[model samples]
Target: MARVLMYTTAICPYCVNAKKLLAQKGVSVEEIRVDQNPQLRTEMMQKSGQRTVPQIWIGELHVGGFTDLWALDKQGKLDGLLQNN
Candidate 1:
């Protein structure tokens, strides 16, 4: 499996959904709660170019948030990405 990192905030519905979906797909994600750490939030924005909560990175690929992730899954590309292929 690819390295899955999520920059999330506490009480974020999208983040919760994203996690659930990834879990359902059998992917274990490393979650970085930006609400608890300002530095991580800055790093997330710099790395992803997005200041939104629930910024997700699959391996080295910036997969965006819940909407982007679901779109990839809908297109059947998420699994391939998760496998790092």
Candidate 2:
């Protein structure tokens, strides 16, 4: 399986949902709290090209936010991504 990384804030519902979805897949996420560090938020923006909480990376693949993650799952593509296939 691939490593999961997420840029999230303390009170973002989307972030919570994203975590829940990943958890359902039996995946562990390394969360970076951008709310605690302005610089980290900036880095997240730079990498994701979006100023949004719950910016996710499954291995080297950028998965955007909760909506994108959910879409991928609905399309039956998220598991392969998580498995690094």
The top-ranked prediction according to TM-score is: 2
Clashing pairs in 1: none
- Per-residue lDDT over 13-58 for candidate 2, one digit per residue giving the tens place of the 0 to 100 score: 9999999999999999999999999999999999999998999999
Per-residue lDDT for 56 in model 2? Answer: 95
Alpha-carbon local distance difference test for all models: 0.92, 0.95
Consecutive 10-residue window with the lowest summed lDDT within model 2:
76-85
- Tell me which residue pairs clash in candidate 2: none
Candidate 2 segments exceeding 4 Å error: none
Give candidate 1's error at residue 62 in angstroms: 0.4
Write the residue-wise lDDT of candidate 1 on 1-85 in tens digits: 8989999988999999999999999999899999998998899989989999799989888889999999999999999999973
TM-score of 1: 0.95
